[model samples]
Target: MGASIDERKPMVSGFGYASHSSSGIGSAHFRGRGRSHAPFKTWIWRHWPLLMVGSFGAFYLIHRLSHMGSSTSAPKATSQSAQQLRSDSSRVQNGKVRLSDLIGASIHLSEVAAHEITDVKFGGKEATEVKGKTDEGVDEPVTLADARSNSVFVNGLRELFPGISILSEETDPDLEEVGISAINGVELTHDPWLDLNDILITVDPLDATKEFTENLLHFVTTMVCVVHKGKPIAGIINEPFVKDEAAVWGVALDKATEGADLRVSHGLQPSTEDTVAGADKVVISRSHTGSGADVVSEYLPGKQPVFAGGSGYKALRVLEGDANAYVHVTKIKSWDVCAADAVVHAAGGEFTNLKGERLVYEKDDPMISGGIIAAADSKMHAWYVEKLAPLQSSHGDKHRI
Candidate 1:
């Protein structure tokens, strides 16, 4: 559900005024007031124009003087604000905090949802169940954690960015209360600077639910991606199981002009060094490796593929250069990969489908039928796509739905 341009008038404050029609405040209004002083009233009536002009002149002069004072002091204030911003930006190790200030509430919302998934304990069989199969024919499960976290994400995003469109995986109205109550006690920051026109916000309140149910907490994540005109511009991935400040966020700060580059930063950790040695490594899905092994064998040759769960995690493996590339030749969803795609691209990495085409995040359909291939750099990505495209087209044709 994407918003149209006409419905996206930002709710920020600006200069405005209320006008009153003179007919509503005419002589009839003055007559109701005590007017016993006839001599004064007569004199005032005759001299009213002169008195009004003098009063206007005096007020105008005072207004100009006040404005002059403000003009004189404005630069210093502006300079101080600019200096403070720079000082704040300098402390960031990975992500551009300044550019992401507009989406602070979303980042916080993802973290809140993540923490709820890990920190809260569920009761009985109510905690988990096999929900249904995904478009890719994988058995997807829905957990109390998933529902509650999704509720928080959906409700919180709606509250913070009412004008922006939202798409969440779990939209059952009955389950909303599980997470909506949590938001009442939370206080999140808001920034009114980002343009909301034609923006679509997608959320994966809980990813790797099967891993979570199995107590494999490391792979579980809460994700949010901001898509503008079919491109992901900002993304946040929160690992609730990670110790402290377990979030990694990225913003395509220059997306309007150059959407390819992104500024990525860890929540509080330093940027990890490229530990990848001469022998290349590839990462693929642990649970659903459909055609991934064949892809690595046919395209990567000598490289051994490492298995992992969660698209966000696999993308990070490539982002950290622990793996040279990540390839998947099965169906996937926009919410599962959009945040990771933004982060990898922001850091100057490359992400595209097996056909060597950039994935479009149109809100009308969340399914990305072509699958994905992400790499730490452009050359490595090209290397994989050149070898794998034909094989992918031949075997994974159903994925092209």
Candidate 2:
């Protein structure tokens, strides 16, 4: 059982003393023990520790109550900071909803673009024009399908997110002007977070034009990537000719902090395993394997390298575990790799240049000059980086645009 109050020493409580002796007040009880009742000031000085503690608690309570009753007296900066915090939180929540909607729209646009590609590919004979020569000096071709698919994405996205900038491989200045003029009178939807000036939408309406022209449909893809403040945060890739499944994949990241929904659609989602184990095979570009042979032979010694068309297809090969890594030894255009890079990294993989640096999607530069090396995970990426460090500097002007 607990001891009785009289059996214990006196305790200092609040502004008063707690004692078992009811016959005295203040220090009177101590007088019997040779200590006379001290004056009020002396008593307060002797119990200064307790008084200070009590005063601080009361002050805190009053301060809290003042804040609860009327926050107008608080520092102006503090009130503004609290308001800004709430505003940021609201923006993030709205951003998640808008990003989710954007992902859905991207999937639908990809499917629509796929149909456009299919119609053009099988449409008797596709009239082609030599748009220009690639960085590798090969004649780059464009067909009617390219314009149609580009329109589907550019027109759709501009209508949906009118404030965001778009950079497409097949962006026609005249077409853009027409699209802008068309949407000028239309009341477009607005998303506070996505409507910011820093957002960029990049599109590769038809990733493998050469393969598509040659009826090599398996390598064809429709791709799009979303870059905010120079960072690729979302992506979509659609395999138009793959017969297996839905073939459309997408992912949006930064959900917890920036209000993005970390959700991925279909094939772009991360697998159940904590990490993927691989290194036996490497997927290289079929058309632009500039110095891939020597680099792979020297660094990835025993591994087998398979050459394939389309940057998106090569990236998917690594993501689906058909290959451990995807290595490109020549310069690549930004639009060709941005969506693939985003999709690969979003699924717990790594995508970077030969120097082990991430590719930046700046508005002025549309080229990834250092080539690329994408691996399944960090450990595999580090292994590749260590092995391929030598060739990082060898691609001199060949990689430059």
Candidate 3:
């Protein structure tokens, strides 16, 4: 007992001293060394981080392993109230997503198809309406309520996740809609309600419209998701026009329908030049509404360049070895990039600010407005980031997250 106490004394001293040095450890409940588990102080003191990491790792491993098993052995559903898929039963006009089918699944274009039976027109007043301002004085016009009701393009997604906050520039309850009725319990309604506890879903109904109107490759919708605590959980941006699943654009339509179409890249590839060499003579905006062109032009000093549509589409171009990189100098709404971000991250490309820092999600700012530098090639990415970092520093206009 004395030996055990002696060994643990250093840890106790360390904790007490650290806490004292920093100030009262704010609402921290030390689990193992508390009164009931006091005897385990020695074990807990040295292994706090290890335990936490191991616990999370174990849970993830178990979740993945259990996925191979049948539903009979799966854990019981927890978020019951939101699981009932209220949107499907209320699918009057179009764009109905059966939430029961989409949650926990990777964001895929086919998932959009499952609800596309509702024939939802993605961009309307719900998408184009000017809603409000973001944190850094950048303008924001998310359509959250419209997503819950009228458009499966957005509303179907709301039905997918239970506690998530989706900031959609289109279909948000904040604005009026001609055909769709609203869902109950969600914070937004035609009456103007607020539910801060739920996760935020920020989306742009139609990204890159100029490209779409001009008959570009595809006009995609931007969708980004954040949990209540302000972390980016997932992102999806689907082509509103091109049924990527119809052809070989994204997944094999046959494979995608079975929920096996999620494409995740490991990390930035070693060389983008060889991969994308001579594939096409054009580059375009991933979103049709069109942005970042002037910023992209900044990268090309004298080249007569081309542009495409949608945030995800741009990132995917790099992954498919098409474009070398994607450079954005302005703040973009979260929904515009979130869904496609999953594809880019899965494709193994790298995304960051000019400083090479990862972009994070925040609740208060509906649009995760910031400049981005994405690359298919590490060397190419590094060169561009290093070159632009100085400019970003000099300008002092880039927002952190």
TM-score of each: 0.66, 0.67, 0.49
Q: What TM-score number comes out for model 1?
A: 0.66
For candidate 2, the lDDT comes to: 0.69
Native-structure RMSD, model 2: 18.9
Q: Could you tell which candidate, 1 or 3, scores higher by lDDT? A: 1
lDDT of 3 by residue, 1-401 (tens): 23432233322322321112123242222444335655456667776776676567667878888887567532433332334434322321232233212222224422343234124343332233445654445444333223432254443443444444455455333321122233332111111112335345555555554343344535444343333234333344444455534211111111322233333322234246643462332344433213345444554443223466567667656666666676666667665565554445445456676677766656567555446777764676677677666556655453232
Give the per-residue lDDT of model 1 (tens digit) for 1-401: 75543233222111111123333321111223475778547846776666576567667877887888454411211221212212211212232222354356667687778767865543343377788986557788888888778877765654334335677777633312222222222122221144555577888888888788878878888888877678877778888887775577776545354333345555422222435552377788876665566667766678887888888878877776567788887778888999888777767777898777888898789888677888877777788788776766566664332
Write down the lDDT of every candidate, Cα atoms only. 0.65, 0.69, 0.45
Of the candidates shown, which would achieve the greatest TM-score relative to the real structure? 2
- C-alpha displacement of 244 in model 2, angstroms? 5.7
Clashing residue pairs in candidate 1 are 94-264, 94-265, 95-265, 262-346
> Candidate 3: how large is its RMSD?
23.5
- What does candidate 1 score in Cα RMSD to the true structure? 17.1
Clash pairs, candidate 2, are 255-260
Off by over 4 Å in 2: 1-97, 173-192, 255-265, 268-278, 394-401
Query: What is candidate 2's lDDT per residue for 330-392, written digit by digit as tens?
Result: 777889999888888778778898778888898778877777889867888888888877665
